[model samples]
Target chain A: MEVIITKDLEKIYNPDTVPVHAVNGISTSFEAGEFTAIVGPSGCGKTTFLNLIGGLEAPTQGDISILGDSISTKKKSEMTDFRLHNIGFVFQAYNLIPVMSAYENVAFIMELLNRPQAEIKDRVMELLDAMGVGDKAHQRPHQLSGGQQQRVAVARALASKPKFILADEPTANLDSHATETLLDLMLKMNEKEGTTIIFSTHDIRVMNKARRLVKMDDGKIVENGKPDTA
Target chain B: MIAKLAWRNVWRNKVRSLVVIIATTLGISGALFIAALISGMMDKWVQNQIETELSDIQIHQEDFVIEEDQKFFFEKEDLERQLTAFANEIKEKAYRIKAEGLAMSAHNTYQVILLGVDPDQEPKVTNISNYIREGAYFKEPGRIKQILISQKLADELKVRMNSKVVINLSDIEGEIVGEAFKVVGIFKTSSGIFDESHVFVKNDEFAKVLKMKPGQYHELAIRTGEEVEVEAFQTELQQGLDADLMAESWIQMSPALKMTEGYMDTFNWILLSVVLTALIFGIINTMLMVVLERTREIGMLRSLGLNDRKVGLMFILETIYLSITGAIVGNILSFFLINYFGNKGIHFESWEEGFEAYGLQAVIYPILELNFYVLVTLLVFFTGLLASYFPVRKAIRLDISTAIRN
Candidate 1:
């Protein structure tokens, strides 16, 4: 099932003084359980497109429908609620709360969802173990290596059981070894849990790991298909 | 969960948070201590006056209160019997003959209020006996009438203890009577003015010279039980008195003290406003910095589904934690500081003369009520809430996409 569909999505910066079309008329959709990567050079509007889909920012024009509900029609506060209930995010820097332990970071999303403590505990441990970070559950983000922190971040994203996860450059800061580990953990989550994930990356290795790839340049998709075919 | 996050967030920057907490502690405690000092000073002044000069309650012939003439006198026997009925509330009662008179010595003459008292009964009602700086309170035994003059009057008249002074005053029949009295005691009180304007003599000798009977006394002073409500007791005593007489509590007799007591609350709030105002700014500055420093973290939380209200609540909780922690420590510190200084006393010996002129002692005992501490803590809590406004707004207004990039 298609979880996200963008219809001619657009975002313009400094529209009045000097309009810059960051995401110009993008059209796309992602199926559930697809480990998809949107690949492009720097400033190619990959993050903006993800943000539009995640309801983190409003598009100057066009509609982003997540599970058949158009997010462009929602108010700012309503959009925040929508984001909390339906979307989970993983940033390039692995933005896990520094003050929280890995377990706590994973549990935080479910807590925000108001899930029961017992259920949150079971789910958090399950996800942490799946990500191969169960033993590091009690360690804060600062105490973990880059790969471990990214794994924790993935667990946090999956904790909410959202329709899809939006990851922005999930491995840009990691070494090749850490990047390989994080990608494997994410691929495991995608296969085992059927979690639809759409991430933005410039790394060829990351694009290679994606089951599907959408290649972009100058804020428009140049290609979209299987990674090898694309 | 929000509270936990906020609390842990406060300690994220230990040095910055500690600076705010310590500043709040000093501000709140300093305000409370200053308030206690002033309160103690005022309370002690009124108490001292009531104990040493004006007994807790006083009764006089209505005409005598209106006009300070020797002719206006009360029937002592009947009034004494009436006062005894309140024995449970009235600890001690004394009757006195008060006259506007002049004390003449070889060197000088001074106008004074000549108070004729039964020394034994007078000492029971008032603490003047304890203030005797030289000799004893009417202790000399002689056919020559003995008197007590304040050290202030003694200095003015160039007389010492046992010096001879002449008492000249009006009798009840409006006749001028002159009599010789030897100063047996020289007393001093906290009030320099009270000391200079009053002289005491034996009631029998005073009455003999004035050609009056013991029953015709001008004033009746009663020291009531501390636990008794003074105003209510005064009203009850007044209702029980004869139509020709009137009773007054110390507050009624001294309106200035009453006014000062009323102003104390206003004074406390003013001091708290000054302290809390400073505290509010300190919190705002610190919290603004917190928001600025945690932009990316806050952005991450926001992007992770933390709603605007929850984000605002988290910052509010953080501000409250900082302020309340300081308030709790500040109040505890104030409690100990007030009690310590209250017992030890804070002396201003250099200003002794100025303080004494207004019936105040040089040393002041700091004091505060339990309700005041509770009030200050609540003010600090509200102050925390108020101080959180700008920071909460700043946090909630962050651009999630832009902040994440930071």
Candidate 2:
């Protein structure tokens, strides 16, 4: 099943002054069980594309239908509503709330969604156990290692039972061992749970793990194909 | 949840929050003080207006007050008969007989307020009994028909208590009938106008000297329970009395005195408004700084799926929390100062120069009363809320994306 699609996707960084086209004329679809990666250099619209697909930002000139709802025509408040219900994002900096411990950071999204206390506790414990940081649930972000913090971010992103996860450089702060561990977790979730994954990254390990790779150069897509070096 | 979050948020920047709290506390303190002061002044003016000036009723010639052009001299026997009947039914009365008399003393001769009273009934309806200083109240009522002269009048007369003086009563033929009087008492009424001019004599003595019929009367000193009840009593008395007699309550007797009180009340309100407005601005400044400092944190909360209203609720809750905290602290501190100074006032040495220079006998002990705490609290609570209102709006209206970037 098609979990996400964009028609004539275009995003402008600033539409008013010297409009900088950040995403231009892209058409795409992601399947339910795919692990996709969008790769590019700086200012090449990778973040812009991820923001659009996650419903965090609107397209300057295009359409996005996520599991069949027209996202672009949704009101701003409604677009945010869609994000809250169906999408979860991980930023480059891990973005684990400083005030919350690892367990609380992971449970934050579920709390925002007003999940039942029993369900939230169960889900948060399950996510933390899966992320291999169950023993460190009480540790704050600065107190934890970079890998542990990023794992908490991943746990938070997946806590709300979203249809897909949008992670921006989730492995950027980790070493090789930590990066491989986080990647393996994401790969296992995608394969076993059929949770679609869309990430923007420059990491080769992240790129190699992807089922599909969408590469962009200067706001326009240069490649959209299977990541077999073809 | 919002309240919990906002409370936690306040501690995020302790120094900044403390700054806001202190500034707001100062504002509350200032506002409370001024509101209390104004309300106290109002009570003082209202007290003086009613308790000191006019009595319950003033009995005069049927048409005397209206027709001052004709001296329709009071008939003592007939007026006394009516007064006795009035006294029988309503005991809150002092028959005050008044006449315009020119007095010549050692240093100064001026027109004076000569009041004649039943020495027995003087203490019944008014505070005149307490105003007597050097001599005792007329014990025999009719036997010791001596004058209780005012301190200022005594000073002008160059006479001490129990000194002999002569008062002249004029007849229809313009001949002066002088009578010797022993100054048996001195009245030092605190109010300046009364202290300088008023003199009291036994009613019978005044009648004997003027040879007014044994029962003539001019005015009535009447008492009621409270100042607010004066007008009610006056209106009731007016309805019962004959149209020939003219009656006025204190409010009408000295329109200027009442006006003085009314103007003071207005001034008090104006001063409180100015002080509280300044206080509001002070609160807004502190709260705005607090809101501006929390922009990034607020953005993070918004991104966590907290809606605009939840964010607004957090800020407003914090503001109310801040206001309530500050008001309590400030009220405690200010209430101490109010009590300390309310009872033992700060003397105005500066104003003494102006008062004495103008021959204005200074009021050395100006009483500062703080009986209206509820009024002060309510005024401060509302002002505190108003002070926080706009800052709350600004906090709520933050653009999350822009805020996050900053």
Q: Scoring model 1 with DockQ, what do you get?
A: 0.85
Best by TM-score: 1
Residues B67-134 of candidate 2 have per-residue lDDT tens digits of 53224456555445554533434546667566656655556665766677877776776666776787
Please report, in order, the local distance difference test score of every candidate based on alpha carbons. 0.91, 0.70
| Fnat, 2 decimals, each candidate | 0.83, 0.10
Most accurate candidate by DockQ: 1
Which residue pairs show backbone clashes in model 2? B56-B222, B62-B244, B76-B215, B76-B216
**TM-score, chain A, per candidate?**
0.98, 0.95
Cα-based lDDT at residue B295, candidate 1: 96
**Clash pairs of candidate 1?**
none
**Which sections of candidate 1 miss by over 4 Å?**
B81-85
The true-versus-predicted C-alpha distance at residue A133 of model 1, in Å, is: 1.8
